[model samples]
Target: MVHPDKASTDRTCSCRINTNYIPLKLLYLFFIGGQSCATTYRSLFMRHLGMSTQQTGVIWAFERVVSVIIPPFIGALSDKSRHPKAVLITLFLVGAVTLSSMYFVPQEESLNLTNSNVSASENVTAATHVDIEEYGQTFWLLVVLVFASSFSVVGIYPVLESTVLGVLGPQNRYKFGHQRLWASVGYGGAALIVGYLKDRSAESIGDMTGTNRAFLSMFAGVMVCYCCAAIVSAKLPVRVKRDHEGFRFQDLKIFLKKPDACAFLGLLFFYGIDSAILEIYLFWLAEVKFETPSFILGASTFIGAALDIPFCLAAGYLTKRFGHKTLLCFGLGVMALRTFLSAIVVNAWQLVATESLRGITWGLMFVVICSYTSKLSPKGLEASCMGIMQAFLFGIAYSVGALAGGAIFNLMGGEFLFILCGSATFVATVAFGMFSFLVKKKPYEMKDPGDCTSSLAFGKEVAESSADVL
Candidate 1:
């Protein structure tokens, strides 16, 4: 619900961009760093604790627990603050302190033992063999660090990204790709560094202590990157009213009964499953099916992701040239084609080749989704809607995607399972796509900000809004 009286049309704002270009660069870096450290680095970091597929599963599950619960809740908090920028800055500082503790936390033994059973001494995580108690202590410490670093994902991320979008407005949407391109650059660069280190030092790191030290360096690198991101985040000029929504707990009961709300969730139900397949299975197709080493997995994926830069730019152009719905359909259709191709990929080269197709679909989807979400954002609850989107939908999607993807691999065999993922994407796309079209009532006009007094809380609304983006 947007307040019709809220004269704060984001496009019309005149706040000065005192620290403009450089902060934008830092924003890109921090955005990438925040995502990689908070979500992507978990696999490598888990190995250091000698976690098993199951133990690692548990750790990730725990992290997802917070991700599922906190982001939207905190998003509500961000929506109301007089200065959401301040809240974002504070989150970074808190994350820095929490993440720093990873340098000194004890390891978890039970998880480490599981990893050893799965992989040999050489194959196991470097710290796996340190006495179980020490490992347990560190693992527990990591649980805290994971929670802390997640500030970027759970709440602060929407706050920060919304701030960037608020500044860029509709005019500069084309540049959004450029910003995300920097994120791909950071990940690709990090991957190269990690690959070089692992290849060059694999033999010398035969000793457990040496392995542990190397993994620590990786963690430290992630922290350094995040620190730089925090610096960039401090300087963006974002202006939006900050006040809590008036929706209450009772509204939560009938929240979905609203027509647009029902249609939106229905669209997401399948969209999420399809999106989850790509998130989890693509890497599997590359790493496992192709027998690509873990060290270079990031590098290979980054190569494919690098292709997304052009797609992102193209997406911006197409979205602006055509419309949000058109590009989204195109992107989803491309993904469907890619999924179909992935099922039959026979080698690493084939996988890489087809994986290149991923950029257009993924890049287009991202830009379209973000743009659409921005259009529907209520006057003040921008972060809240974004939070519900990332956490409630995609957060759950990622977690289930990981576990379910693995199960699919085991049940159907990797090739067949991947094929199934592609098919699901295709079928679900049609289903969800139709629903998206069905919800075209003037969702925005029906619900004004005044209608959504504090009686409403965060993302739940009687009409379609930003949460529909996910």
Candidate 2:
């Protein structure tokens, strides 16, 4: 028989746990929905503004660098903050302001430099056609706004994921996919709507060009969604740190000594390369190579994001059945397939069909990576671990991929680039799968201080074997 006091306490705890679900779902919906508004069509926006592919890639690479540098610091700060929700609110506001500012940046009217070679072939002297100083100023302003947005936007993910994981606690971690699925719903819905709005805006005759019209609608949606997310963030349960007082650099040594962690980070870098290539260039292929309409491009993202919803909902079951490492390999394999198909597709619809695999590649992959990282992180360093993981996945790896992709696309064209990305992903996936099979390391656990020696010894042995294999 349960004592009255104990039963009451259990009921209260259960109620608190139940309350987090709605807010978590809404948070994912609004935040990711906000990002999808601009992210899906950003390349097109810049292109419409007369910026060259290389210029856009440079901006993207710089933005990713900021993502790498900012997240770890933000994560650490969030971990230590007495009011973590306030930190999130501030990030939301910063992102809202900076991203919206991009919509207002004046579009380059006279210069249409799509490639460096084009600029040379046209024999266009900047002094004859346009003022070089004014052009440089406009371009640099876009860069500044994008960089400012990056500081807040990229930093938000790690802190948000850590907070969600902390709220769900260890036992309920798998249910993360359930909460995250709402992001797909929000993203898909918003993408579809925004795409429709862009088409409508494009059809209208006005002083503003179609790109500016589309961007105005996108910025409006982004701002509204972010503001709503900020408002809802206040209701989030503040995580109480019980195991340690604050995050310390020493806590990270435990993570660095684990061979599995090291290997996973390495895998994340390659994964970032594959993903970055796809995200940056796929639309370019459809729009430029195949002449796909804006609405169809938007429809493709909607379809992909819609597929993500089901996959995300089933992520927990899939993780349990196949395991994290296997699922990661599977996701990589699927990415390779997508890229290979993208290289061959002669039309936009077929490309869209191939992109339908986005759900399997991203939705399953994201949940598994976050869960695995959370499992590996030390108690007080959850946010820090997530931040580092994001740095590798989005920042460093993405920067490399973006720069390389841009150069390759300029020199060799999109088909060859996609083929190269496919082959690289395939090779990396196979290698990582084989490595994990040979490693057979015990699953990571938060160890007591006394267990450090044994853990370090095991890590050393694993490292030695890995070096021998290499």
- Highest TM-score: which candidate? 2
Give the C-alpha miss distance for residue 55 in model 2, angstroms. Answer: 0.9
Question: For candidate 1, lDDT tens digit of each residue in 148-229?
Answer: 7666545665666666655655344334554555566665556556545644554566765423554554556566776776
TM-score of 1: 0.71
Candidate 2 positional error at 142, Å: 1.3
CA lDDT for candidate 1 = 0.56
Taken over the whole model, the C-alpha lDDT of each candidate is 0.56, 0.75
Q: Candidate 1, 446: how far from true, in Å?
A: 14
Clashing pairs in 2: none
